[model samples]
Target: MGTWIKETDKAIYLMDGAYYLQKIDKTAHTGQVEGETFFRTGQLKTWLNSKEPPGFFLVSVGTGVSEPQPLPPPPAPPLSQGITITKSPSQVKIYQPYQVAGTASTSLVGKTVELYIDNSSSPAAKTTINDNQQWLVQSVFIAVPKPQVRNLKVVAGDASDVATLTLTPYIEDHPGGTKLNLGGSVGSGGSNRASDVRKVQERLIALGYTFANKNYETFVQTIRLFQSIISGRTAVRGVDGRIDVNGRTQRFLEAANAPQWMLMPSRGVGFYNLEVIDQPWDKHDYGIDWMSNVIKAAGIHYELAYRKNREGIAPIAVNDVSLPQGGDTIDHAGHETGNAGDLALPRLDGDFGGITWSDRRYDRPATKAVLEALRAQPWVNKSTLYFNDPVLINQRLCSRAAGHDNHIHFEVMVPPTP
Candidate 1:
């Protein structure tokens, strides 16, 4: 059979039934080209290209002519219009089970959808889209350590949308009376007189409710949260998100914000107790919870940080915190509230007894370490230390005092609200 190149109006052609035949390019017209065969139809069109060849074609093996067809072009990629947040609550309880639902593009089906709070790179929760192009994150919790507004962002591929939400603490508001009074109603559906609303708003701010400015939307939700958590009966009060004059909500808010004290438990986690020395009736361990937490944390830090092996070091000894009722004491000039306390300095022999700084048993390094740890607590008010250690005083750790020669005296202030 004679072999030659064949051309058609719409395309060029080559045909052979021998599957093992090496591909013959247009560059070799006179001699047999030596290479792999183009027996497979997938690579046939590429082999039949006319651009880089010596211009030769092959003849058909039999009477019927065979023509190679090009494969159809691939379909275009789908365009993304972005994801959307469809169902989300305006107010959600902090740390409680919450549901968020949204819709994404069909292209994002089976792709991961992430829910973020504010600008956080880490996702608060995630889920995959269904065949219907919708996603739902079920029973995922949103954290709100303090009262504030949050922006929830749902993202799929390069598309995202944001929804605003307010978060309220899950704690119940116990019954308490507040001396604070309002001239008129100060919440949703209330008089909302600028002065009355301002007073209530400022009080809420002091109690850790946060808002950018005075607006009814935020105000109503905060009030509703406050009302919902107020346990116990104060007559016929309801959770209406409104604070009428002399209402139970107003009373609860006042009582919640009152100056409360907590008595340090006897022999607790990080620190141990050393009860009243002589005046048992006057000396006590009653102090506010925040200050007590600072002391306890300091004790933990001192034991863990000062020595590599906490096995040998005795825990910090607490002499006094405040009276059971928080009043004047004959031994101290200023231990009225839980604001101040006396801690026996660390001893050379790791004893819990008191020792003056001048005593040979005084462990200056250990003492300084504990004091430094105490000062490092975030809630500590950085009050002046009342110990007579000249070296420590020079190191800015303590100040010399007239009567504070036996132990260290320090005070703490209440932490400010956000």
Candidate 2:
């Protein structure tokens, strides 16, 4: 992974994104810019049921689609299997395992050669190659190696005063099988979420939602017409920015205390059993990045909700927020309820309006940082920033939103599914 190609008179005579070489001219006339050379690198194949095999290329001058003479037929993908050995008068280095293998190649020193050998790494035979770096080897290893068969080859260069050598790797498939498939990942959490209530509110302001700035999904269609873009399409700010709720506005408190009292689905108040590609359980994508960023901003620490999504972004759940109805009772229970997700209380800095989650104490720094972090995500739809006191929520430091008290519920806007 650390290899880099340098701009030189020579070029990548071979490709696998790894083969590197400089050009050599035995005679002055061959040094012309039109001159060319050849080299070979190994092949790569996929072994995982879920992945694809990799391929390499044969690079040569005059092959650039000029419809001129095609240098030759390109090598088959199978040729990438074996080891590529570069031999100097005293050393032979193998390419691809990307690291040291055994003792054979490194122990030898003496004898200059830049080519040869075939399919097998079994060194056809053995002889006197001194690693003492003071001698030369006359022995040849490997025999009758096929170009397409994965194997190792000895490439020795022609020397007089030339510093460049060709790099040709012979790939040979093992008799049983080559057996290749190896790699690992970490997730980025967001301080905000797709369903953030506060984000939904600020975006309304960004879209001219209203002075009240509440009940997002209910107003999404109306605000959609105000979100004008360069192309002249109406746009909503998406759930990006959030207002401090606990201050002058009891909006956050209203929503947090309200939604629970609303009419729940037949499934119940929190029946969110759904999946989206952007969800942690889905394949990795930009969605996960947004999620993690939102949580981080919220001052909450989380164990990845889904592993598959850890590779990319995960989608968020789709639900609505509303005011509570009469005769509604609240239940604070952790049952892995699909609708009610948990957060690291210490991470979220605790509850607002004397409301506490999981016995964790809330901190002001996390609260402010969380607000700032969510402001950074583009998908947030609204926010609900709660404060311990109402005056703190209405303070000048926070924007001039109308109703905020309990907490700031943020939102991230996801594109409509078509």
Best of the candidates, lDDT: 1
Name the weakest run of 10 consecutive residues (lDDT summed) in model 2. 178-187
Per-residue accuracy of model 2 over 1-418 as CA lDDT, tens digit each: 3222222234432122434322222223344565554333221111112143223334344445321121345677652222222332222212111111111233233434322234333432222223432211222112223342333334322222112222233323321111111111000122234344444444333322243244543333322222211112212233222223232112322221111111222121111212221234421111111232333322211111111123322112222221121111132211111111122112232222233322245444444433433333333443333223333345422333333333343433322211
Tens-place lDDT digits, model 1, residues 195-239: 887777766666544541346776776676445434211111246
Give the residue spans of candidate 1 off by over 4 A.
1-259, 276-282
Which one wins on TM-score? 1
Please give each candidate's TM-score.
Answer: 0.43, 0.19
Every model: Cα RMSD to truth: 18.5, 28.9
User: What is the lDDT, from 0 to 100, of the residue 155 in candidate 1?
Assistant: 72
The per-residue C-alpha lDDT of model 1 at residue 58 equals 46
Q: In model 1, how large is the Cα lDDT of residue 44?
A: 53
Q: Which stretches of candidate 2 lie over 4 Å from their true place?
A: 1-362, 381-403, 413-418
